[model samples]
Target: MSNSPQKYKTEINFSNDWDISTQDKYIFQFFHQQLEDLEANQLHVHGVKLYKVESSIVVTAILRHSLPKKLLLEQVVLLVKNKDGKELAKKQFDMALFGELEPCTARPWKFLFEEADLLVPLDEIENEMDFEMAFEYYEKVISDFELYLDENWSNGLTVDQQGYVKNLVSSLEPIKVNEISIVGFHFEESEQAVNIFIIIRNAFSQALTIENLPIQLFDATGDIVCKLGFPIGEFQIASKQARPISLSFSKEVFQKENPDFSSWKIEMVPQTL
Candidate 1:
């Protein structure tokens, strides 16, 4: 038999050098630090996403617990930067995600920046790493922005001057009933009268007028135990104020079936507009 030359064939495949797990870890850590910073100021950030559109960059995030009681934030500041550790732009959102928010709820927020708003061209950003580094730089500047708001809230609306005018008008307007609450009651046997204490909260910016307010008391079975009316003749409650009122009722007005006022519930009757 004639000797034959040996023949061999081999196949090779190449894998990407990037580690996806490492990228994920970096993103997670960046967001964790952002959340921690927000928590220090009693705010919460749930999620964030970045997108490049044409000549602009859009940032969408979920904000949680952004508003606190007795404080309203009419504007928010957004800072953008480049991978070279240079600030790119700063934008202001005139309105919040919602006009009003229930406590402990999440709301979606969006911030848009155009080419003119950025310091560098979008093409200069090479990869995800560059974008991430820019966002990291933003984290440090946001705290100063928050402090600026605390001190210059009245001037926060520079771009939209109309907002400032509207705010001024609202502050000068009349107050309205925001909430009504019944505190407790005291029965004066010697005076043959029962004094019911109530707290009325006016959330408006201006004073409110309350006149001839009617209140009713009910028993455990929802039966009418007593009825009384308060003559707050021309009484005006100041803006963002909580005022206490005491209504007196004679013992003769109490129903004989439920004369005891110990287990009674009190409520304010709605007034006709």
Candidate 2:
């Protein structure tokens, strides 16, 4: 759903994190309530502030629910742009993953836009906060049956191959947010390395950067066939979305037994204590 906010006339607050003198409680207020003879279900945004930092701009805004009941959306995309219509950042949020938003209730939210996500330098930003915030709501409910693929993971898959994976996930159990699971998607053996394509599911609410994460491969009988530590960057699985990732190991690790991993079952392993 697109955002058709009825913008208010208040001046937006623009201040550095250390400078609070010029800051106001709210820079802009958006009223998306149902008007006369019209229907409106948009999520209202109010009391916004842009706090700029060295590497990121933190957006502090209030999110209000206008739906009849408590709204829990798992997929919502927010786009931020400058006054001149230059794009700043666009980020997706899992509303249900974070918490429930009650009807007509207002809550504060913060969106961090890193330097990599910004399209232009920070200096060009308007002091009066002359930018716009737009929200896009998606109806697709994320559940245990879905696997959101990282760009790197889906780049190599054919359209048919992707569809097969989607179908394959229906029979698999849901991976919880606190659990880290590495299930085999596909694998190939070579003279030097065995590249194992994996579907990594992480339900954690926040993204984490790590060095080595354990990946366990087990046979149908629940016996671990092999265990390996793979170096991973950031593992961020959306609320109910699993992601496909690839891990490669030296062929020597599997020299003892050549196993057909397609029929193997994946077991959940805790990320930490």
Every candidate's lDDT: 0.50, 0.59
Off by over 4 Å in 1: 1-177, 180-182, 185-191
In angstroms, the error of model 2 at 112 is: 48
Clashes of each: 0, 1
Give the number of the best model, judged by TM-score: 2
Model 2 per-residue lDDT tens digits across residues 68-165 = 67666576677777666667777776555346665545555677777776777777664438667777554433246357876765887889998888
Candidate number achieving the greatest lDDT relative to the actual structure: 2
For candidate 1, the TM-score is 0.35
Candidate 2, which segments miss by more than 4 Å at Cα?
1-146, 207-210, 219-225, 254-273
State the displacement of the C-alpha of residue 105, model 1, in Å, after optimal TM-score superposition.
23
TM-score against truth, every candidate: 0.35, 0.39
lDDT agreement of model 2 with the native: 0.59
What's every prediction's RMSD, in angstroms? Answer: 21.5, 16.2
lDDT of 2 at 184: 81
**Cα error, candidate 2, residue 12 (Å):** 56
Weakest lDDT window of 10 consecutive positions for candidate 2? 29-38
